[model samples]
Target: MHEGATLGRRFTTLRAEPHDVPGVDRWVALDARRDVEVTVDILTSLAPGAVRQAAVRAAQVRDARFARVLASGRENVGSDRVTYVVTERPHGVRASDLIHERVVPPRVAGAIVGEAARALQVAAGQGIHHGFLRARAITVADGGRVVVSGLDAEGELATQAGLGRGRTEQADAAALAHLYLALVTGMESEQVTVPDLPDALSLGAANLARAAIAGTGPDTLAQVAAAMGPPDPAALRGLRGSLPSLPAVAHEEPQEPHAPIAVSPETLAAAEHQTELSIAAAVAAPGVAAEVAAERIVAPELEPGAAVDRSLYASPEEAAQFSRRTRKAVERERDQPLALDTFEEINEEQNAGDDRSVVQATLEFAQRHLPRNAPLDAAVERAQDRAGRSGPLSTGPLLVGLFATALLIVGLVAFNMLVSPVPMDGLSTREPDYPAYTFSPAPLPSASPSATNTE
Candidate 1:
């Protein structure tokens, strides 16, 4: 047992032996300061230098949804050699566990796929790929938060071990679709019967899943995420059905505190017997026959090769007629003004007469109020003569000069108010009144000065 063994400088105090991770053996360990838990993968079967390359590639990934890598190194203990890769331990149960237990509802499953798709999209932007995405690699945290582990490092390790088949954006989409199907049907299989999906699930979800599974849907993860839209928490909760609890694993005699316990033959037999008995009981239960019949009636056979033509035109005449109708519809839509635009046009037309009347009234008022006067006419003539002499004053310079004069006056006023202090002498000279008190004087002793002369 290497419970207290430390790996890299940051990760110290291994708390457990290598357990089952998606593509590698994972050991839970405390960080250097023991502040948080981290997982370390010992890639013993991977080709030489695989971990190093994966570490370099993973260092560039900055997506929050990815399980961040802490460090990677090569180490040898006794006759065994392995590469260690440390990553943050996300606190959640494996998505596979939930699927096996039949806890994830259809809507929740869509949401989970959507989240994984978002993470994949982020990784794709950086040219990073998760070639080994599986139910075990995905963790479903509280509040439906999905965390994808085993990014580039797992893929590299798998390739080194000759377990990697192929990796592409299309492959990832298909795998995600398969995952969604498994969650919805609670079945672990490579192929899914689209017709078996519950009618309660939306048709859009079914189409999206079918397209992804067939590799005929959106090519990129971003498009897949967009297609899934946002998951409805209320619908998920309402539609989810209760499932039976998982049977507890039988254990043998206790061993060392952190030592691994191997399942005995007796334990395996007992577990198998229990599972068989449970299945038998479920089969013999009442309504079992009726339920199976209902399922058959609800799930219809979907022919994969069946094609439905959704085109509007089937012949040349039909095509011409459809084109003409489409053209007319478009023209009508284009020519139709919006309600606001129509209202604005009508308002302008109605206000035109009122505007002219107002202007005429203003002129008449100005004429009545500002009657012609001899003195005013003389002043205007003199102003015109001065302007002519000045070679026609520029309005721009005159306005600028007025603005500058106003600014100067404002500056002087501000300076007087802020910088200068007013004298207090002329305000008031009266002193504040207070109550007065008189003290009686005591007689002084006069013998101390004469005492020195007498001595």
Candidate 2:
């Protein structure tokens, strides 16, 4: 299939090649429509009912550590039936990859298992078990965040469909322990040796791993989470074992040189005395005429222990001279005025000019690339002008007008309430009928009178 081809009518395949999932025919195809990277597992051979049930169960799961199922459905592709389940793509290397690369620290392993256990707990709460909770199913995201994926609806569906064995909470716990062991020893074997765990890890961490794998320790995931605390940074330093040894180099024939002559005892003793003096001088006053200090501290020949003074220098004058020199140096440093050199001033000016140039360039670039419109420009200008001349927008008159309008409404409502008639006992009484007025004939009159006169 080509990239951008629609999958299930909503997700577009981002790449042509699909990632193969181990022990399953379903290949992971990256989706383009998702905000975060997500993969859709396209299974060519899965029962429709299994797909539907898995989709429902996957949707019901809502845990941060669990890779959420975005969508799942069955679709007809050409002459074949295909089932697809889309899940959020976790953003890190696989736990198994990390395990093979280097030994995972015990504390880090504990923490990862702990996180996975929490996720398992969530799945168990929803009556869903992760049948395939292995190292490859777990991902260590950035910032050491552990994400558990591969909880495809098909696996659960398969189990329910009687094609495979069903997974339980206890089984998930055991798998988590195995995962921890694999990480600690950098091996994927069921037979775990707690003694092989790095010396850097705590005893509690080792025990936790053993308990998890053996089903002897914390039976519940919550208890496991509580037991596996955060890994110690200091302990993590010694997590990895020694590096592999290099190949041995072949030896060549040895060459003989002239024998060295022995040095006189007097010269050796004097050299040793000088070394001791130098060390003492460095310890007493570092960088303060170290060589001269060492020389001055040299022991003078004593005439039968003749009254040794408890002073570093042989005479008081020497001590006074040393103090005077130190004071002079301090005075010189204090008297010097603090000022920037010509080179420093020049550099500062150059830097300021460069900053201005950069700002101008950025502004020009933005103007060239950014879209513009006359109405938007006008609106922005108006907003800027308003902002420049700002006092708070006066709402006093508006508030007063609103208050008056509210009062009028209240008054009208009150008047209507007071004057309106209310029906009593859910019946309306009709008004009594009034007599109607009848018009009397004015007289057949004038015409009849004229007729009578004529007769």
Candidate 3:
């Protein structure tokens, strides 16, 4: 079809090129009678009855989120018979274009997919489903509105029929999930392997995507959408204002040639007469231009205020602000003392190498690059071999480190036992001491002494 060609004597094609839908020749056309822009999907290969039925069901789905179907019928144009469905042209950036251009944050990507799901959920309620769903079929419009095009047209034109409602619904949900994944991961929907979700995605969103990929999504499309929650307004704000406007029809009309703008010589002279006179006078006078240039190059006179030392570094206000901040910081430090002088201690130890403990140094170096456990003998041999190869560094230090670790552990155990030891009587086989709670309260009586003696 060529541009300006009329279909059914109503919709006129704005452009000769058709949108890249796999099996359908979809074009952006203007509905002459309605004075509105709409998309016309011309199907010469699909079943006419199926196409009409799909369009009729799609038209029944009245949603702002969807590009509403206007009409569908068989049209005899020229030598061939074709089935066409006219739907409102969606006004926004297609998800396909947006995802390809830049990396969309997960929140924005999820929001786009969530809005599509909500629209499809509504369509599914009326027994109408978008059997063929992909990123290309969805649009992100201004104010975060998602207008889903090719709802049933895509399926009908692509021959996606005979898939039962259950299957179609599941396919749509999975396709939506794939679309979300593509937006988030910047991969195509047809990718066989599911990519890893970005760390920024919330746990709930990750789980929802994983479930859909595993073929255990929610029972209804609505449930799947609800789990994603509402679209994030903040994320959507970034995508709202960049929607592409609908293409306009190019009707060539006779254009009159624009005359060149002209200005009179007298007007030009009047505008710059004084400036011209001054320049000519300056040129006539010898050394006047040079004097003017010298005057321009000369630095301005300085004003006296604060001394160079203080003012060069900072102004009064800035100095005051800094002093106040420093005082506050000192007060805070005084109130809350630091647990350790970490940097100072480390720097001192690093600088004063002679004062450092040999055993401690060996332990630190050994711990810094400790490897997996090996036989003690093998490790000693390797250390010895390395020490021999490198003269000053010896296995003797490493040996001391191993002995120090063992001695430290033993010392700790001995300290603990000395501080809190088990009683000698506990090791005896005597009957275990009765719990204090088990003994009944002493029979309180005035004659307590006699009761005690009896006990």
Candidate 4:
């Protein structure tokens, strides 16, 4: 096993110098260069974003498409769970009447990274754009816990195990399970598409999360806690519990190497079945997980011809605003799927280069090179079918019944509203086609005959 491979895999490299308070600026390496990098300074900022609850709701679906996309791909499983690192600092005040201190709900300036990840489409063996994450994993050089101080230190304090090995990997199974359940909706058991989850997840963090939330229900904190643990080499082995154990320390090992992404047609098609299902599910329920699943977000109500890639905008705020114009108000259209084939094409240009490729780069290639003129409605329908089968598993039959009832009601209403009294007049038209013609006799010859006397 190599050194720091586990922990380092989740992040790109960061070059840092100590700020007076130890922060980062003028990064030489960053997670992505192709897509706009948003610097979120946590000072009680609020931007438009997806709600965490909706994301959790999507995660709950028991489907296969979701599984294939999440599991088949190399996930950011090594990193800590997605965090909403909130800190309160004084920005300019919105001074309302001081006397009535309104207890306003907390303004969420912090964006949920997991949601951001959905647009990134990080997965196993996908090529990257020339991208790097300028990340610094600081630990005490003297065998003590290193304070992860850079930029927003308070934000650092709020996030994932903060550089300690926590058991987050076990939830990969559960996450993968949800991934698949979101895919194969309406199949029989063989085709039912269940993501294989290890029967016994030894990861301590998951166990703790489960213990914490078991009574209340499946909360995000419990779920995040669940993911804390080891990496499995056989992450793609379809059978349940087939994942082989890798050393926990190996996660941080930079030396240990694995197979690189192969750039070939057959290689691209290797996970086709799995990927197809996952994509179908993603387009259907493109929740916050879209980043991890590597789906481009489709803005709401975009015309079929418009670009729907989530990667286009720098932040969710930009996306939200673009969706709000009278000419433009619509949810983001996840554009990466439209570009998947492009990833298959020029991937060799990006293959096997850690320094050059960012996940966004690979997706950008998809956006740039993949055929954009797809039959948009058809793809959506296909994804919708899969998503419905995978998700809202119970609501379908009810909706069908409701539709039938609605039709009946509509028919009855039309019969009543269309009623009118009969008119007494038989017909309101008269014939005007025939015209009379008169014939004149030869009366002019009689006048001339009078001159000829009594002949």
Candidate 5:
């Protein structure tokens, strides 16, 4: 792990675009009601010798006093270092100011002015900062602990590190946070412990990503990573395969079988006996009988293809004596049925019929003609009702009977009310022991309504 890599990227939200003119500028803007604004001065510096842009990121962390050193003949330096002017003043130079100040010579040609414009745009939009030039160790976290068991110094493990640094591990600060998130969520206590580095990356993060770009093929770096843990780095390989243990393996030689197979004599005898019994039963028992019985059950349902027309037996003694006389008469005609042809003609006529209602009605009547034992009882009940209706006691008499019933019910209720609940305390009451009275016919008064109506 690189010492600086332990640090992660950090930032303040961008506020406003930076402008070319620089001396002191408002770094960030805010809505007074919603957001509180803070002002801080920014200064930028390159690594020893570097170029300066048109606008420094307002939020760049530096000396707070601007400083930079730009190589003059940088084109001549391809991976080669060169000497150039160094200055601490940001407002000291502007491309526009530089353009008018003195540039009569083409040898001191400038980088495209558009590049400077882009720099200004970045300052305004993205809020450029010192960290963008070189990854700075801005991110901070407590380095919890370091536990190393396998690998050692000299870039070695329990085995050894490659002759050179095997690989450069690339990871973002978000990736570090994501890893801890997974570990915490999945309850993963195990972690990788790598060599101490800067940026506050703990052993957990230090060894999290370690691979080699220096090597030609994966053999060296891959072997180191392979030795470190499982062979593949899912995030690196651009795949997601399980880091689970390899399928189980049996390295030992398989045992050879003995010449004579060993078995219990009784077990063998039992198996042989069962097999013999099954075979004997199959050979002797009637398997075909069940099949024959099923065939017999199906026999009554089909007509024989070679059967003579049934009319041939008509008027024969058997036909005269046949139990169903109607069918006998049907069979007697010389114009007897040619069944298959007759059925086809009948079907065609039925299909062509225009009177669909009559067809439906005939089918309904045919269905109803079938006798039902359940309905016999219902028929008897209907007959009883008809008999009752036909009798001399007609609807008028029924009304009279109903009126009489109502009067009887009212009389019973009135008599019950007049009787006392506490009569003789329910036990002391004794009826007068006397002969029951027979009423003599007393004539209703001649002036009553019945008598007057008769008159």
Candidate 6:
């Protein structure tokens, strides 16, 4: 594996070497976002879609004996579309490696194979079969825990010569039997033919393996492991080595302090004098009140240790320093009466007068400033006169209007009578205002000639 390589664009590889799987490349990668370590199995020259689909199915199967699939996808590397599956990193030596060094007793092998078989059974119940189950697919973790890897992405095992691929319960059972044989015999072979076992091997386990190879074994691999019983604790003691020791952490060295900059004697003395001036000015003068000095000086407070005097206004000496125009403007501003003072005087006068509502006083005050327009005044006076007056002049227009309207209607009637061609007598045949059915009498029965003769 390349240094600093990543899988799924999320999990970054921390180790340069991959785990010892037969065909697939497995790296211990760190999922930085989740802050957890995971195993990323990169399958080369395989169908990315098939492996991804299998990984999805494998993820749904959860068991302590099985490594949990976390994620899977295809990532482009150079000219190749690499298919990778991420799973929880099982912390144990692979059964293939452990057996390669030395074969464990049949009982211990049974325990490990049984756990793997049970895990496969669970997966089978959910319709997911481990297509390629080899000795390397199982791991002997701490406390003799057996964890089985390789689920949907088992197609990578097919890349190894002499290993066949089968995606069914039967295939899984047969492969699991093959793994058990390899574990006990310490022989790493992927063949299905049953080999001669040592006399120490249990007859039940031997028979089960033979039947599994012959396709006549129990329906589930778990049942076959059950017949073999649990493993021996003593036999399993030396199978897994001690956990690796943690590396010593190095402490960071403390940094040296920086030296203070050196200042000359004259610069130090000037800085101290400036600080003293600032302190004195702050203590003696309180903002705007400081301007009341006898003689106005430009930035006088900035002078070191300058004394300030207490006064309400500048002295004649300071006033003389200003221009004539400035003095005139100031004098004019001081002489003018304030709006508040004028309002107080007006209020005092009102208090001395007869008691009056505020609204009435306000109206009187507003009237004094009202425009004295003769036309407007005359218009208002006329409106008041008309309001009070009760005579013919006020109603004369309405009366004249009604009389003129009557005269015009009579003139129109006379003109219409002279111009119209239809006669008044012709109106007799016109329909009445009420219903004709109700107004007209019932028609008299017309006398038939025969009835008249009988009468």
Q: Give each model's whole-structure lDDT.
A: 0.64, 0.61, 0.66, 0.29, 0.29, 0.64
lDDT of 1 by residue, 1-455 (tens): 25666665566645555444334666787887657988877665424355556766876888777888888765444454455778888866567666645735566777788889888887888877887678878876654467898887777766755655445676666667777777777665355566766676766677876775565765677666766677443433322132334322233568658778796444444444445445655686566645544433122344898663323113445445555676798899999998768766765555443223344455545544764432333343334333333232248998999999999999999988998788887798789897888666667556797797999
Which parts of model 5 are misplaced by more than 4 Å? Answer: 1-35, 38-41, 44-455
User: Could you tell me the TM-score of candidate 3?
Assistant: 0.48
Give the Cα RMSD of candidate 6.
Answer: 37.8
| Candidate 6 residue runs with Cα over 4 Å from true position | 7-9, 16-25, 34-36, 74-82, 156-163, 188-196, 209-219, 230-238, 242-455
Report clash pairs, candidate 2.
none
Provide the clash count, candidate 5: 12
Model 3 lDDT tens row, 1-455: 55677876889889644565554677889999989888887765424455656777788777888888887765456765566778888776778776544566777777887778888878887777887777778887766678888777677666533432332777788777777766666555445244656678776678777776676774567765766677665666547453333122233588999998795443333334334445655785567766554433222345787333322233445555655676798899887736566655565555543333454456446644763222332333344334333233357999999999999999999999899967988686778888667765677546668788998
Please, what's the RMSD in Å of model 1? 34.0
For 49-140, candidate 2 gives per-residue lDDT tens digits of: 44545656867888777788888655556665455677787876576665555566566777778877877788888788777567777876
Give lDDT tens digits, candidate 5, residues 1-455.
11111001211223443522122122332223334432222222212111222222232423222232211111112342221221222322222222222221111111111122223223323433222111111111112111110011111110121222321221122222222322222211123222312244333223332321111222222222222332121222211121122122123578997699675444344344445445555565487544444433111333667664433223344433443454566668755657767765665655553333444454445545743332332343234334333232237988999999999999999998889475655585678899989886777435769887899
Q: Clash number for every model?
A: 0, 0, 0, 77, 12, 0
Best by lDDT: 3
For model 4, what is the C-alpha lDDT against the true structure?
Answer: 0.29
Q: Where in model 2 is the C-alpha error above 4 Å?
A: 1-4, 16-32, 45-48, 152-154, 157-165, 212-218, 230-455
Higher-lDDT candidate among 3 and 4?
3
Candidate with more favorable, higher TM-score: 2 or 4:
2
The CA lDDT at 333 in model 3 is: 83
RMSD of each: 34.0, 32.1, 28.2, 31.4, 39.8, 37.8
Report how far off residue 85 is in candidate 5 (Å): 22
Q: Candidate 6 lDDT, tens digit per residue, 1-455? A: 56478766689987744444445676788997789988787764223444556778788887777888888765556665466778887776777665545555677778777767777788889988877777767777766777888774674355332356567777777776766766665554344467556567777788876776566755667666676676444544545553222122233579898898896444444444445455556676575335333223333243667664424334444444433455688899998888768866665554553444455455445544653433333343344334333332246788999999999999999999899898667577767698546555578668899998998
